[model samples]
Target: MDDELVLDPYPSKIPSLMDPSTSIGFLQPQEINLADQCFPRPQCDFFNPFRTMDGSCNNLQYPTWGQANTASTRIIQANYSDGYAQPRKSVSGHELPSARKIRTAILQDVDKSSPKINLFVMQYSQIVTHDTEFTILKELGSNGPLKCCNKDGSTPEIIPKECLQIKISDDNNSHSKHRCLSVPRALDTSDRGCNIKPVRQMNGVSSFIDASILYGSDHETSRSIRTFKNGKLRRQLGPNGKSYLPNVKKATELCNVTYDSTVCYVTGDPRVNIQPDMAVVTILLMRLHNYLCDELRSLNPKWDDERIYQEARRLLIAMHQHITYNELVPVILGRDFARENYLLPLTKGFDDSYDQYLNPTTTTSFTAAAFRSLHSSIRGFIELVNEARKITSKIRLSDFFFKPDIIQKQDNYDSFTRGLLTQKAQEVDQYFTEEISELAVRIPDRHQHIDLISVDLERGRDYGEPSYNKFRQLCGLSEAKTFDNLIDQMDKKDIDALSKIYEHVDDVDYYVAGLLEKSKPGSMLGHTFQCVVGEMFFRLKYGDRFYYEFGHQIGSFKLGQLNEIRKTTLGLIVCITSDIYSVQRNMFEIPSSRNPLVPCNSIPKLNLSAWKEE
Candidate 1:
């Protein structure tokens, strides 16, 4: 892990905006050839970047490269006169200091110790941000009536501010303020503001994290959440009979009725009821797809059920790209910038760096600002604990948001997999957790709450992104142009509180100066959000050509089934799907004294007899 801590690549002295001699300065090379005509590409001949089954664009030369543009929404609404402004108030009317109050004034949580990883790296960074950012849901008549700001004038002059809650004026008290209404982004043709549609999981608008975590990138929501027998899916038992997940009664009747049953389910991501750690990693990949369809029908006794569900969904997407490039990109990009960006994974194979013009898509500044710099590693509450760690039950990560009825109780999925292997996340720094900055989801029968740091600075200015010195001059760094050249990447009192809500230094905001820079050593990211989330995961693993370590391609993997899916981990997928016996063979680190606590059948598994069937 120390080839002299890697370094060297730097390069980019500015060009990119897809450099065709870069100038469409504020768009219009026929509107960038009409937003590249909504990405066409699809003529597959094996390289199943999760078979978008012709929903189009799976890297046929960067089909609309993860769409959405208008030149980054006209360079973040050209100094706003009302292209959606708001956030800079102060002069005592308050409301000024926000990216959740500079993440609650320079990340306070004073040494609660243990950010020795775990909590499955905050549930696999929200399942790799719902497989590379989705954001489309909000186009029913293109929204409108939001006014809000009542203060007790007893309601009614325009309400539904999506989920309002701003109210800032301090000096001790007062009333009415909640402010939500951001939503509005979906567009692609009916032209409200043009080009937007990169709902991800189309399998190739930059191969949107293709393993939609086990077969789901919309083929009618993967045939209404599959269950054609042996290649099983449709599960449902709970109240301790175990198994769970099959419900979706109209999306659990819009949640919130204080527990016991909103009944939401049917996974493979419709954001499986938004939280409970994304329904415990979509019920631990639907119990590793019915335990690899009963070990591929006991090693194929005349295979069928659609060829054992497309070969156990291609070995569960090569054990989720071998536990995301060998255990979460070397614990978040640090095994020397993931072995100097070959993004490590080739203990034996043909990795000729598959760059079909490197546009594995998802990059609107790494999906709305450096992969949400791990929202300061969450954790305002969600505990459970036991095997002598104690805690019992905690909850409040904003009441498990859209609550999967606290994952149907009765052993609550082995106390949420022993509180994700004895919990300890929160500490990416520049803090957050007041349950995601002041109650991110507190309905209280519609009084409202969600300010997730003003919904992450209004979703990076509703996905226009740009600022933070134009991504520190598109990641070649330098560009600060004074806050004294961002004092070697921030912290002169966060550059004097971002010079009192930024009047210049090109108006700051790229997720509030990439979560106030600093961490880049063994990496918790910083340095232009670790060079734009390590060059968008090194172009999603060298522009993926069905990238499971690319060995002699054609849907790679079979160097002994990619060495038994590189002995799949994430603590051997919670010791082969939950009722957690005992963990810590580095389930994202923390059990100290050289990572102890074993015995989940002493870890290491993935030996599906090199997927049998001779």
Candidate 2:
């Protein structure tokens, strides 16, 4: 074959059929098939119905393919800290302020004011995040034992000092053994340290939100949870006749931690048992899938189980993409940024902007730092309400952690679903509720609790994310040379608090600095975070070959189906899945005079007839 011709520029229009070829024996084209040549239809056989399981679109072999440092030599030069350590006390040779101390200082509860955003906004943010990125840390084996502080009266072992959190006991002793291991980074050909690997689904990680959060990423896990019936997932009817995830056998066997209750339901995602809200969202999506399956079966009666399952899965994934782009993303990133970044999908037809060369893998920084910024928006308690918007009861978020059985109780799911709509999300600020700040997961009858803020900061370092200044420069912002530079982005008090822990501005952790910065207008994130997150979603939307909105792809939704997908929203989804009677038109925003709650029947529903085949 002749050497491939590389053209820097080409003619705007193809030569007409009447025009003769410049080269002998060569034919002149009348039109150019740019879509086929540039982005050929993907082979559907390899496509996982649950997710775009193959890494052909994304850089799976090398997940850190598009990072600032991709060269093997550059990995050696990268800075990898054991943990985010505090500045030293010069005289005493002791650490001045600890990570926990800094957390308590800047992340303390200032006011319990709920923001204008609704609870679904917070839930969707977390659900979308869980779908894309999940970084697993290396557990301490027999070799490394966690070190306990002398004050706690527990056996002391050797561990990284920076990983310890000073936990004060009821006896007035400070026990400092909260072990946090560094996340193992991907190794280069020579086995040198590189970017951290996402343990969750990485292939087309951004496409259709990976569905890892809905169906567990592994095939065996997904198969175990699925019923394989009429293309519908298995679900059990609760005492109230509402659908709930089927309970697993010996649930204790699947516990992530010792304190977790063993009696949890088996869902596509194992994290369903991690938190009540997570379970709620997972069950909601599962129900949506079943509902779509039923509709598709009705429309295509002759379709077999496999055909119905694939189409229903396709529609379900499209619905998720639609909600994320149209409903959830606009509220979180603000409408302006959503439009500016091309995150919004067209109302009808296909988008031909899918770039085969673009990698859709989730970034380590995004998973470890930027996306986790929403922790500040989490309320300490989960409220249950009635149609009258009356609060029936409030459940502490920490208390329900890893104990999803509470949602399985009689009428509890309905109450929680109602609460999701009526309740307001915590304000988006540097301050976090005490439940999340100090007592993230409290084991029943156990005195110890995990602090999420500490985990977030330490996780950033473990993932080998660069300092705040480095990321700012990476995101095209000026690197802060002095503490004063951050003043514009962060409050004076937060700046003072950060300075006390970090010796220099360059040493600040990305999670701490980014969360403390002032949020962009109509957004819950700061400029740097918004830039990183916005860019991530932009690539996720534009780079995937099988993106639901794009027409003419091998397995993409039909134009009419895509239009129907655009009609889908979180409000309609909740109404279809749950027993809720009324909801706000824009479920992502708090119910108000402008967006008031209406009867569930009043909400617009997606027309399944659009998916009908003649």
Candidate 3:
């Protein structure tokens, strides 16, 4: 059967080419055709004072620059092994080391927790990542993951072209007896209309830091979630009487739901139920949106639903950007990096840094390699703590994959919220817990498991990302000419491990080498990753015309409104939205003598009076 002809829910721009082994030829200049959807054709609404749901018209000049469903922007050109759209190969014309083997060799099982920061840092990082980039995967006819391995643990006689199954060995303890990990290639704009362009992956979500995670990315999705009457998003009351995200019936297909009453949630982002931490954060933002609407409506009783909703949405997006730059970016990239690059939000005045010429689209390096290095910080289990900061119960993180039944239980929402704010995340390093390294997501009815460490290694190659040394040079660091010269950026032990597995210094994958390097001062990432991530954030701010801090843009907030947004923080957002009574002043960091837990009322909130209209 031609699986490409199958009805895929999220269809790709080009149909799958039938032959897997044939090298695709480039199209002649005259033969190249660009489909209408391939390029942005936004009908920008100037003077709207609001961003469109699909991210259109954000850049008035380049209507689709940061729009959803557009091709990702690349800092460095893709280096496909076939000079077109194939996965990258090793420098010696041989296959790279097996992903599972790389995992076992470099990443050890360790439970090292960060001393200064809490798991909220890791959890919120996921929220920011989901907001900025979401690479869509090729799907089977049933809209499910492609199954490449047969029941007998053998490759299919006629494998589908979409299947890039990770080859595994039986001796691998994590898999037990499974021999393959099914991994479908991410969908891209390759071979579409014979465009003669390099295969560039598509981002399912908008590249802008708009609240697409709360409201959907497209108009249809955004409308589906709204009530249309009171400017509130649809929500179902939890067993505890507090509002929660609306439920979907496709729990059996999308989630590992073990209960009958509770099903998977319907959120702006489809990956919401991927983990409980992500679920809690998504719910918080959803609640924040509705909360802002209620406050805005109370202040402006004559305002209609559309006016109230847009005003609330505008505030929510501003708060989201504020927390991301002020709290999240500083922690991950370091405060000094944030200041030096003008990545921080201004406290009082407008930032005159909007650049229409710059493309704010998520880069291949940031989405595929540099940003993914933070996976090392994820802990093995999701801890539930009481208001008193006492550990009541712990759930193995893997067991709850796509299963959010536990979160809907009595008091579990607040408990999990507190846990994230109080518990320390795994220290950012090369090590990973067994939960992620061994028992990651498993293929249905198959004994195989997806090792995320392995998946990250393979994803970089699949994206045709340049090797570590090249990226090092791109970041202005010394590129190693030989394996021995890697000592400057990498520890002696890390260089020794790379020398054993890789054929040459140039063959080291970007994600692997970046994670292995020592952390720069006061930053969670090493030099190359810091530089790449630093540059990525710089673009996300200046390249964005509707940045909350900017003054002269079509959607720019008033000076008073912008200043109130500056007062927003992760602590205040959590305090007002959820049932948590008190939290640390800086929820991103562990509660210390300087940054101690304070009553919710003590935390400064956006005085909605700034938004009151005459």
Candidate 4:
């Protein structure tokens, strides 16, 4: 309750804000620009050497954090009859100890065939995933482009894109593979379907209403907490898998237009619901912060724990304050506590002398540190209000969270720089230990990196290794290497050939399609990504044990959700009364063999005159 308790510093021997161990690099693309472009000013500097905010501002007097002595300064002295430049002081010898640097080197330089060999070292399997075209169905399949060309000149013949198929190889180690998505465009009623129409068809054109809402996180209706007798941590259960997709529910219940023409996102169950995906999103955000802090501390060796912690805190608070304050938002969201009120008490601790300062009361009933700490704990309770809004859009801060009418004035850019938010992801490589695929849907060809790096685990077998596990191994991730030899032949035709491997594949393949396919509109892939986000947070905030448990629960939930999606996929197919060529049946619930997503030359721009030149 006192100011003394909050303002008191650690003992003299303990490190202050001047230590080198703390720094949080702005990681996301949106966050990076906030730090680099919109912000960065002298006032935000954490360890101000001049110790005065009055008009006395001098770059020379400011304590240099990391930058070299590049500025020139002169302080007038009446006693100095002659002017002379001070000799350069070397700052390098105090080498940083706690920090570690990634080699910044790449795998292309590593010898894969050595004792530290990998899958690509030995060649393996190929896969062929063909996409269908949309025109093949319009006008009774009369006109459309379906072939493809060898854009890279890899083949002796340049296959016409309209009739072409793709092939990938793994002869030598490395990615050595490529695939392209066939884009599709719908025809205007003004053109193709303008034939003799049924009397009820208005303007000789047929239009259907789409029933999918913008992706919203599962809006939970229940928040019941259950306790366990043995003291094991309790976990939260998400919404029922079936109700997650709303369109699917609409189709079966509504009856008006041609039964199947209306596209919907229905699941079978009536009791299902949706809510904000907090578990994953929050966890990942924290993990990134921890990783950044830990990396900086490793730079200072002689630095004791006290010094390392304080310096890191100083560095983090400075950067965090600068970016968060100068960012593009209202001022209330970017408060930095340590800099303003708490002072001498924060500096009191050193060896045993500072112990008494930890909780001494101040006259004001609360110290500055105590005030800020209390504010944070109370704010954490209101975090869900923000999480609820994130489900709709990554940057829809105003809609869900509190938004004051006050504008972010032109000058404010110098204040709230750290609040920028975007989904731009960093690649999984040396700089980062891992990149989480925490989206609700698996984007098509999302596994290209894994496929690019995978190779044969054994010799001479046309058999190959699993694409998923191979990808993990290649990235140096800890995963059990199953299907030791899923890659059989390195022939460029591997994936294409795998597409036809009906006997060789299993439920897991479709399940994988379930995971990745969720990214496809109507497929609802964001749910899966939410799971990834949850696991990321568990690892970052709580550590590996929490991540493992959370991941297992998420995996189980996804498996259940996929089963519902599979039913929906079939429902959509059955509801289709028309093929690409014509309405095969007037009834809505007709049988179908064609896949809804097949490209069949559906991609148009690939053959565009402008694109052809490139």
Candidate 5:
């Protein structure tokens, strides 16, 4: 009765908690093999056929293992020496696993921590597609500068103190990227980037913000590409469309891989192009979503809210430091040298990468559907934030979730949205609603309105190639607010430079909303959206690749208490974690025993008979 072969709906196969020896455990990978079901004929209908696949794990543990599956007990020198036969009882009738299995488990655990990843690749034979582990903080001290270099971990002649960090623990996400190990702001923890425990204790990091801001610390950022010729259009973009000051590239150095424009490739410095704050934010949101997704599921049965918030906030802070320093600055400063002109690749992705990479399978139909749905959800999220600000006079309503919202609602909006948002905010700063405004008018049809709500509620983040070209334009010189003392003095008969600029931003929100609204729905788009969210999560959780695989493999930093349950219509997963994310000072719990999400529920199936338990 292999669990995979059983024909039942979640039978009670887990071991009893009452057993003191239950101890902690993790999953290991194994071989996969299965047959495809057909209707008494070689050529089966293509619409929906039973495609069976096998996924195996090495641990051979029984709770997850089924009846008749043999358990391989480790023959330990200490166990044998402990006197179970100390007195030299008659030759035992017991049988032990072959030496090969014993050696494999011991060696694998030695090379890695815990056991194995608990996931299965669809249609593929792999049992684990991701490597989830722990990170120990290696602080750079409060006043030290942040920096990034080649994979060798080389120190730069000059260091940028800002950084973006991303990290992931046990994965609860269906997509690999959602498990993160990255952050966007400066942080309290540092890592040598491996599972090998550093001697220092794990000092929990805060979410991205002014360190003082959380304690209430400081937060901020830069770069250059080209100059705008007349009628060439000043490319800077922002709220109300104003030009910023000319790009102030750090004059001393050539920009390194500045992610500005096409020409940056030939001439601009790679270091000069700074990574976008949005990218950093994207990673932050992704990291927490990735890192905690699984652990929370493990403890999904009865974990508290405080534990979730505490874990999310800490991961966010670490990422802030990594993103700001490593990727953001280098991306912004390269194109202009002065940090001014040019377009980026984000938009061209539709033409360049979207067709070739993203929509290779389904083309426009499905991706557009999911994209539009996500677009609506994001817009609605923005509207809700604005509504809160209008009512409370600041963008502090989110804080109420952490601070005052509980007082207002008693139980608060702690459902999937808040949970997802809180997890997202943990990775990025609370920057989700920086520039969103909806039309004051709403169609009075309640049914239509409810449909809108459903669309908004279910929408996930954009996974289509990002529109970075627009982002660069918005952040460049053209978008900065103008300020000159002499302008007022000459204003009596002077031409208004400000009015000329004002027209550009008059409908920024409305224009974007229309585009978002037009995006429709489909399964492919939904999967891509899931992938994008996963990618962003990975980036945020592991903002710096300097450490490699984000250091998840070498840890005793196993999953501790977890709490996850976000089977939202949006296909979003919100997870909460604890000390287990970084410092491994605890035990592992039963996975999915508590998670309401049914295994393989996310991936649609044409044939349920294969997965069904009889």
Candidate 6:
């Protein structure tokens, strides 16, 4: 009854010769005029204090090095099937394991919870992910909306080049009736520039930790969200008479609203409506902006709306960087590794390590594979907690996709905020709950769903990522010559599972292999991911001239103001912005005996008086 094509997991013949001197192919088949290509050459204001909306002008010589809508960089040479634009293939030109099948075998439901890391860690990671990476998935084709499969759930006779749909075999019990899962290819930099050589995907957001998710990446979105008079963002009245994110008039296209009364909120990123936790964080940031705006206006009465706005923005960004490096990075990479790699912030003075030659553009390895290891930590339900820290109710994560009205209901916002502080996150491992595997991104009315694990696996191939062995070697680990070589990194059971599914050790996918590796001491990530993520954070800090701790730059914060930023923490931000009265000093970790809950006032606060100008 199984119609799935089966092949021997072991290789039967020698791989084709890898040509070293191969010429590169242009992304477009036709020749393009080089002179007509448009590039960003922003006029740098050397003395300006604010960053450009699109992240240009950061580096004086290279204006668009890490700007929005630019092509992502690569750690190693791409391995495209055509050496240009097609998805990557195995060395022997055979199909790799089905992403869905691999998911079923390795990442089944295991309902495990972390010991100390709270739900806020997962929520903040998603926020950080949105800040640094966004690959625009192309949906439309020469026709209207692209559909790669027939109405009867069968593959089309002629598949479009843009559709990289994952084929579901007849033996796939989870999707027995579905033959394929439609996936649109990511947009590349060909339309803007870089029409030459091996194709790379475009990062739609500014590739920096500059809070592009709070303020918009482009000039239009930024200007639209402001009131233009009080250095404040536009807000809406919630059911509890508190200010919340403004609602978009037309959201049926963006949000999956089940009822007419269910409203969709708008923010800097359209993905805010993806879930409840994302919307909660966005709303909290909005409140912090207004709260800071009021304080800045009172302190610097002579300053105009623009000065107050830019100053407040700068301060907020500084706090974000501090919390990310100081609080968040330590937990993921371990305090020791972060210090050894210079990824942690200095406790006292300014950091003078801004390097002009380094490119801060995010690498494809970090985006497509390494950072995705955190996906296993997502819990099935969003728990709601009362003021007493007792779980009151819970909502399934799958039911709330593209629907964020839950936060707008009476007293629910505070309940969810408390929940993030109290609930424990799922442990990082091979297992994923049914909420993520069976019901992720579900469309109830259409009776459709997407397997996130499949999407991740397919995305790596689509981006032409190299094999797991290649990445392991790059990270200074021993080269895996045989499947047994993986024993040092993964358990024997995991290695056996991989050996059964893959033909050779070299054929393993980076995303799959990275997850199976045992985590390092005091860190949540494995050795390979720790290397990739650690390097990225290092570049993000040392390469950006506007980094808060870096002095002597036009955009640099003053020593006094910098000290105030250094005092800021994620817990304090949650406290000052929301109605929650007490939380642990470090919200990234749960309240344990060692890290006890304390009143909000006792926590160190950002002293805005330091920014007072005569």
Please identify model 6 stretches exceeding 4 Å from their true place.
1-38, 139-145, 191-193, 259-261, 442-447
lDDT of each: 0.60, 0.62, 0.78, 0.18, 0.19, 0.78
Superposed model 3: Cα runs more than 4 Å off = 1-37, 140-144, 194-196, 258-261, 442-448
lDDT string, candidate 4, 300-364, tens digits: 34544434333322322222222221221011111122122111111111111222111111100
For all the candidates, what are their Cα RMSDs to the real structure? 23.1, 11.2, 9.3, 30.3, 30.6, 7.5
RMSD (Cα, Å) of candidate 6? 7.5
Off by over 4 Å in 5: 1-375, 378-408, 413-436, 439-548, 551-614
Q: By TM-score, how accurate is candidate 3?
A: 0.91
> Would you list the clashing residue pairs of candidate 6?
9-503
List the lowest-lDDT window of 10 residues for candidate 6: 10-19
Instruction: Give per-model TM-scores.
Output: 0.33, 0.79, 0.91, 0.17, 0.19, 0.92
What lDDT is obtained when candidate 1 is compared to the true structure?
A: 0.60
lDDT of 5 by residue, 321-367 (tens): 33322222212122111111111111111111111111001111112
Q: Model 6, range 498-521, lDDT digits (tens) per residue?
A: 989988888899889988987776
Backbone clash count, each prediction separately: 8, 1, 0, 110, 125, 1
Worst 10 residues of 5 by lDDT: 119-128
Error of 3 at 496 (Å): 0.6
lDDT of 1 by residue, 1-614 (tens): 63335553443221232343321233232322333444444454444534453223445554444332212212112222222322333324433344444444454444343348766676787787666556542323545433344543234356442322333434312122533323333322323343333211112222345567445655667677788877687888877577877876664344554444466676655666656777877788888778888988898878877677777877776677778777787777666766755677877656777776655555555666667767777777778777766778888777667767777866777777777767887666566666665566532223455456656665565444556776665555657676778877777988887776666666667777777776666666676776667666776677666667676665576688777777787777777887677777777776767888888887767778777767
Residue-wise C-alpha lDDT for candidate 2, range 34-95, written one tens digit per residue: 11122223443444423443223233232332221122111001234322222223123333
Model 1, residue 346: distance off in Å is: 13
User: Across residues 453-477, which tens digit of lDDT does each residue of candidate 3 receive?
Assistant: 8878788877778888777666655
